[model samples]
Each structure stands twice: as structure tokens, then as C-alpha cells.
Target: MPLHKVIYLSNNAKLYLWKITEDFDALFNQIRLKDSSLARLQTMKSENHKKGFLAVRMLLQHNDYNDFDLYYDAFGKPHIKPQGCSIKDVEISISHSNDFSAIVISEQKVGLDVEQIKEKALKIASRFMDVSHLENLSKEEQIKKATVVWGIKESIFKIKNEKGISFPNHIFEDDFNFEDKKATATLKFNNKEEKFKIQFDSEEDYIFVCAFESIKN
Candidate 1:
């Protein structure tokens, strides 16, 4: 319904996930219509657009039902500004699947992604799975292992604000026991090494996994 989960990674970095169950028409009415035709075309994409608009309403605390003036950068990232809010240096990422739309906000540049793990071809895992890492797991453990690895790579891409990074090569996972419900990923980017902690939880029939950059000294 509201603030399903709040993850605090550091003093300045955190994430907020909200579950939307409101009617699409009410959600659409909350968005301000722009004169530009392109803006109108964008809104027609799906009901998710309306949900995203409503989800953001809680963030700005606006009640007039006016659409907040928001835009994305050349790289397709959402940007927001509050009239009287003093907090700057905040970054956010929004994702929606099924009946849930999540918004992750942080003071540092951050990326957040949630995937519903599905059955896929095993060969696809080779693209992202490290040879050494795969050798250690048996046939059944491979799927869960690969899913966690893929999530780590995706989160890193969001953190780096770029794509085209090889999963298994650029991102590697250390010895982890998924049975413990927590794992860690070691990633190399820009010639620097960073570590990300991955946490997995079961929501209904879905496995929700998230990765966040560890606080640096």
C-alpha cells in the first residue's frame, strides 16, 4: 500500500519501495497535462505511467493534483526538484512490475532494479557466469546462483549509469551461501574495485533481490 520496504544503505543512501493499488483513472487525473504533443504520446504508453506519476505524488507531498515538472537527462534518467525542499544531491530510480512500482532515492548516484526470476535457457547464463564460479555449483544450485549474479551486474550498470558491461567478466561474486539469504558481489569498474551486498527475500511467489553499493571510507 505505502512504503512496503525502506532500505538504508548509508547515512545518505537509501531506497523506498511502494505498492500501488489505486485505480488507473484516479492516477491519471493526478498528472498535469502538458501542451507538448510528445508528452501526451508518452503518457499513452501504459497504465504504469499513471502509477509512476501517482507514486511520485507522495514524494513531493503535493495535493493540488498538478503534475510536477519532471524530465529526464539524455541518458533517460528522471530528475526531480521540490519547491521548498532543501535536500539536494538526491538520485532516484523507479521500476514497476505487476501491481508494484518501486522508487529508490539516495543522495549519491544510485540505481535500483527488481526482477521476477523466471525459468530460462541455461546457455544464457554463460554470458554472465564466471567459469570459476560456475564450477563450484551443482546443476540445481546454478539457477539461483546465476540469478543473483545477474542482478548484481544489472545494479552495477545502474550505479555506473551505463550499459554493455560484461556480467561475469566485469562483475564477479565471491564465495557466498545463498542459503544464508545474503550474498556479496565484487565488481570492477573504471579500474577500481567495489563490493555490493545482495539480499534476497520471497514476496508472494516472487523472489525480490536488491544490490546496493557499500559505503566507502
Candidate 2:
């Protein structure tokens, strides 16, 4: 079957989700070879990375499959040019797991991440959460709370283009019912605060959360 596509447009940003259907062998053949070293391991990780790259190319509307060049920043984020040209002032991030790959494109610096919620959520809560957040929730409420918290933190980290921001300390989300389809998050940075609305969509077994800065004049 052909892959599925999801597009989200808001705040001058475009978010695309591509659902993969090709087998690993067929997908691997689509990858371009840079050198003899490219012919190595056909492992699952390598296959997924190829699919993720292809998905981004499709989103960018590349006509020829091999007619693009990808560059990376010091942090290893992918940047694209049509064969050999470059587009300026555009930022993008790509993420995938299991069956889907997602990409976010924006005119401003943006951060995007998608995570599958798991039972291990509770175990990792303390590492990302701040005291006030812990005090506000009971043991049973922690998992869902942690997922939203982590998403917000990840989005901010992507925006800031750095890591190690303590959630509930550097950021905070107003009280929200996780069962709701959407929620808003407020982030505090350097004594200034910005607000964003987070929307959720469930695809198969994973939840996708997207947060972007509001378009302001």
C-alpha cells in the first residue's frame, strides 16, 4: 500500500507525517550511495533512517528521488538543498519510530518531537520533572502528566536548540486533562514567558504532540 500523509499548518509552520509501508529491502535500495562504505549493514536502524529521509524528501516536493543533497548542523539536524542549492532561513526537524516518520518545517527556529508512551514513563518522571509538578500530581497521575511534560520540554529543547532544561523549572503547563484532545503550554525562558497550544493525535499505538510558537506581529 502507498504511504499516508498528514499535514498541519499553523503559525507559519508546516508539520508532515508520513506512514511507512515499504519493506526494509525495497526501501534501502532507494537510498543514494556516497561511497563503498554505504553498502554495509542493512539493519533495522539503517532502514528506518532511510525511510525517514525519503519521507522528508517527498514532503519537500522533490521530483527526482536522487536530486537532493542533505546537510547537517553541528548537532546533526538535517538541512536540504535541491541537488546542490540551498534555501535560507528555514528550519526543520525529523522524528520517527516503529511505523511513522514526522517532519516539521517553519520560518522560525522550531523544535518538534513525537514519542510513544510506555509503562516506563513513571520511572523517568523524576529526571524530567520539577518539584512543583511532582507535588501537584499523585502516583497514579504521573505517567500521563509526565508524557505531556516531556513533550513540552522536548519541543522547547528543539526550539532552544539545546538540552538540559529542567521541566517545571524552566517550563510549565497549565493544569490540563490528558484525555482532552488538546492543551496549552506556557514556557518561561530568561524571565520571559511564551505560550503555545499543544494538539494531540493518536496514530496506531503512538501519540503525536506538536507545539510551535504563536505567529505574532
Off by over 4 Å in 1: 1-3, 7-12, 31-70, 82-87, 121-123, 131-144, 179-181
User: Residue 193 in candidate 1 has what lDDT?
Assistant: 85
* Model 1 lDDT tens row, 99-196: 55555656665556665555452357777766456677776576666666666667667666655566766788776675776677777766878887
Q: What lDDT, from 0 to 1, does candidate 2 have?
A: 0.62
Q: Considering summed lDDT, which 10 consecutive residues are worst modelled in model 2?
A: 35-44
Pairs with backbone N, CA or C atoms under 3 Å apart (clashes), candidate 1: none
Per-candidate TM vs. native? 0.70, 0.70
True-vs-predicted CA distance for residue 77, candidate 1, Å: 2.6
For candidate 2, list the clashing residue pairs, or say none.
none
TM-score of candidate 1 against the unseen true structure = 0.70
| Shift of residue 11 alpha carbon in model 2, Å | 7.1
